[model samples]
Target: MPRYSDADLLEEIRRVADVADTDSAPSLQNFRDHSDIADTTVLRRFDSWNAAVVKAGFEPNDPQQRIPTEDLIAELQRLREAVGHAPTIDEMIEQGNHWPSTYKRRFGSWAEALDAAFDDINGEAVFESRAETEPDDPGTPGPHVSGETLLEDLRALADELGEPPRFKEMVEHGDHRARTHTKRYGSWAEALEAAGLDPDARSGGTQQVSTDQLLADLRRLRDELGRVPTATDVVEEGTHGIATYQRRFGSWSDAVEEAFEESDA
Candidate 1:
């Protein structure tokens, strides 16, 4: 990743927002199209794209303003034509007019949204359907795999790999694509939880189910990870989600700092 300073990032945000020609800041996808700097790099400098936009002197778009479902599907179709394949979540975020979360709220998940847009008049899915390459092997977004089966397979894979299996690891060894779990459980991390596998073996063999003071718990997690624990880590391992932290402490970075300071105190 390019090591642009904070000023470079803010300037890029302004450039993207100006190209968007709107009063509100451009979405992350829009920023990506207009600049060489990555969205992740910008986000790491600030806790969020919205925070970066605010620092750049533009108002971020209202996240709650729902796009019409039809418009979202149309954008998906356009991206499909551009990429010449089924659009993945990354592709959607990078190229589509709207974000993946918008589609998730509309159709329950990104895969389901593809079905909505590409399903034939006869109810056969066109975009995400797997052709039966073999009697037993249906392709990706393959035949519906049950949640229990997904979790069980995750366990079996963890036993084989001696660690929590990433989505890519399951490609060659799993009954289906590791990402198939996301269709059932929303994400690979959740799949690991459902299967009871720990990413860091040092984290013990189990997740903490404590409801202690938020700062103390955050401190504990940072100690366990030996670094700042992301919001997803809290959701997967801690007792509360990031939304709860945001409500109590304003922002995730602020909460992390306060938690570390409390430890010093």
Candidate 2:
């Protein structure tokens, strides 16, 4: 096996951390599985797996042992009280007893942590409280989701459904709604267009490339892999990323369907 520098090993650990769920902490197994470097190599380089994980800016392996979950929750409550409202991640990072990641590890997500803290204080659900407190929904819009984030979510949902999403599909299958998209981009079609999709091409074919070219590429990949290419497969092997396909044709499934249609044609 090739020897990796300490910086490379640290970067690999950070990558694992990035992909890990907010409620869970990254483990040695995660690092070993995701990275090209072996666990033994990591141990040898850093003197221990935990040491290597620590160097990557993540909390220690037994974070709950070091800082009790109750204490973490208590600190979250304290921070909320200090701010007189739900504290943002940056505020928690700056003012709380521990890093925001600690809260995430303890509660799956920062929003969940806030909900728990709010519940603890007021004995009411966060959603119910929000509804009661902010009667005017239009005046108090939800958190600002960036265009890039919205696009990323759209592509992820497309990958999951195997096709580009319709307005109703987005409301049903996606985290955000048509109204959210409309608020951000004026219309659902505009959001799709902004995400690199041609809203006019409702047949799941894009004007960017000829159907023949797309079919040829799909057939070529299928021949190479000896199976139908998944979105991940297409991204790694094809000219365009999965998002590109979703944006162009509405979804990866749609793209595949279009390829078949072209083949028949």
Candidate 3:
């Protein structure tokens, strides 16, 4: 093996420090001191100096090659334990920031870094679990369950009913509100509907309605329908009033029946 001059060896140490620093390219002074290449000699083996630097664990010019600053600091501490020496503050900062790309920077992706940094100060590295489906497939957005928003609507419906129904049953019955219902109750539709949504009528289109309109209609049916005639009777009693009700209250039995009669031909 060809032996490097004293200056060449110094340059190698400088390159090592630079890599162990933040992967900034080793300076000309570093090369001058650390390698066999003499300033005055024929420059035949300049390329060899590069290879030597690589062997010394210094990457040349890679932007993303992050030095393991924390690990390096720990090692520096360990060195201090025996050799009574460690890098100064500037050196520590240099080691942590701005790395070269030629070397493998960190172990995992950005998400892994975030998980490790923000979650646990002493956390061990963890690889991400692979997704079961291919990326292009229309799979579930996240872990599957009835959406929480739908469940909240269900809860609101239950409150309108003045008692919780068996929400799970209602959900199982496939009411439009079932998703909302399922979130408040356990993941069961029957349980949610049973929470007291009267899924039989609500789910069946016996009372065709959106959630808020349904609540209002339920209240009207309980309170005002008895005072008036059937909803149909009330509708026929006033065209403008029925239109107004349809506009404000959504669908109703009377309006539905009248429309069906008009279209029956």
Please report the candidate that would top lDDT against the real structure. Answer: 1
Candidate 1 wrongly placed segments (more than 4 Å): 1-70, 82-139, 166-183, 198-265
TM-score of each: 0.39, 0.28, 0.17
Candidate lDDT (C-alpha), each: 0.64, 0.60, 0.36
| lDDT per residue (tens digit) for residues 118-234 in model 2 | 654442255346556654343233344455777776778767765556665676777654445543553455456667655434445555655565667788888888887765455
Please write out the lDDT profile of model 1 over residues 81-199, one tens digit for every residue.
Answer: 99777676655644567757677777887668888888642223443343333223523333344567777878897888777765656766787655456434434554566677653
The C-alpha stretches of model 3 lying farther than 4 A from their native spots are: 1-247, 250-265
As a whole number from 0 to 100, the lDDT of residue 258 in candidate 2 is 85
lDDT of 3 by residue, 18-75 (tens): 6545345563334444432232121233333344445445665432333354553344
lDDT of 3 at 75: 42
Q: Quote the positional error of residue 81 for candidate 3 in Å.
A: 37
Provide the lowest-lDDT 10-residue window in model 2: 135-144
Which stretch of 10 consecutive residues in model 1 shows the poorest summed lDDT?
Answer: 121-130
